[model samples]
Target: MVRMAVHQSRGRTQIKDSRRGCPRYQPHKGKSLTFGIRPEHVTEKRVHTASSQVDFSADVQVVEPMGMDTMVFFSVKGTDICARSAPQAVVGAGHRMEFTVDLHHMHLIDPEKNRVIGHRSDDKAKTSD
Candidate 1:
């Protein structure tokens, strides 16, 4: 669970999320910050085109370090989503914060899957046919 503070005009509000861990949001008069609980996300789909067909995957993750005091931005680059933060802090100590986003939307690829795809090397040798 993450605990954070939402800075208000008068003071700040402490917030908490079980899924994302401790996060604090500090708001300014004319600006605000957002943070993503998950560090990475991957979307897999089949891309169809008149010329050819190919597998397309959109991998996204919070570029900045994931911590209690960080802000997240929602923007896509060539269909890829990238989580970014403003100059201000998003997660902090005890401050009340709230969210209306579904944590499930932030999906990351399983590490085990990388091994099966030959991205990781194994010491064992293959058998002859």
Candidate 2:
């Protein structure tokens, strides 16, 4: 779902899933565009068994412990994204760490219309209704 151009400033874009190849986000009829990954899906472990994976290294900016999940803030691709970590993630501000993106959880969007391009069958079913 994440249709990105892999820049050098950040990292390369790896498309592992694409089992459905690439689908259109109706009314646009174009390729996948912007995408978003929820913090909850961001994990310290790179899920090699997952459908796809995206990796990057960023400097930790903040760490907010919230009982079960710790909120981590870091900058990547000139944007700051949060990640949900365990109670003891052994991460702290000013540290550079590599993070992995779970491809199955990517929320892609249509560039022209800034609309989410649903890639799941459930999405298609809901939209059809």
Candidate 3:
């Protein structure tokens, strides 16, 4: 269990996510996103505890699922990416995975809203009159 400490001028407050514990992600397979290969440059890094460190690239795409509990997708490149079963899998900052495409030339889509962010270079252009 994780405990967060909140301090007030008068006193202190301790907040716990759970007293005993709670299950991780529930079992439900409804919708999932399929990511492709993309390139990105290494941007930042973070040190965890005193031993481990995470490296992050400038072009990595971090995706948070709609309503699910503990499901997140990290897109390193167009075709290369990793899925985390638990949130604790990805720790620190600066370093995530690796990508082959630049940060500016990346595309992402939110199917639920029918919204697309970014685009592929080879995609057909839409001309406006």
Sequence-dependent TM-score of model 2: 0.66
What TM-score, to 2 decimals, does candidate 3 have?
Answer: 0.20
Q: Give candidate 2's root-mean-square deviation (CA, Å).
A: 6.3
Better of 2 and 3 by TM-score: 2
* lDDT per residue as tens, model 3, 1-129: 111122222232111221211111111112232223232221223233321123344333554433332233444334434333233343333344422222232223435544442343223354321
- For candidate 1, lDDT tens digit of each residue in 1-129? 121223333343322222232122222222222323342222122233322222222222333454533443333333324333332433332332222333433222223242221111322334322
Task: Residues 1-129, candidate 2: write the lDDT tens digits.
Answer: 234532221233334433323334333333445768899888675546755666667889998888888888887667778888775653789988777777667776667666666556658788899
Kindly report which residue stretches of model 1 are placed more than 4 angstroms away from their true locations once superposed.
Answer: 1-92, 115-129
Clashes of 2: 1
Comparison by lDDT, 2 against 3, better one: 2
What's the lDDT for residue 91 in model 2? 75
lDDT of candidate 2 at residue 100, scale 0 to 100: 75
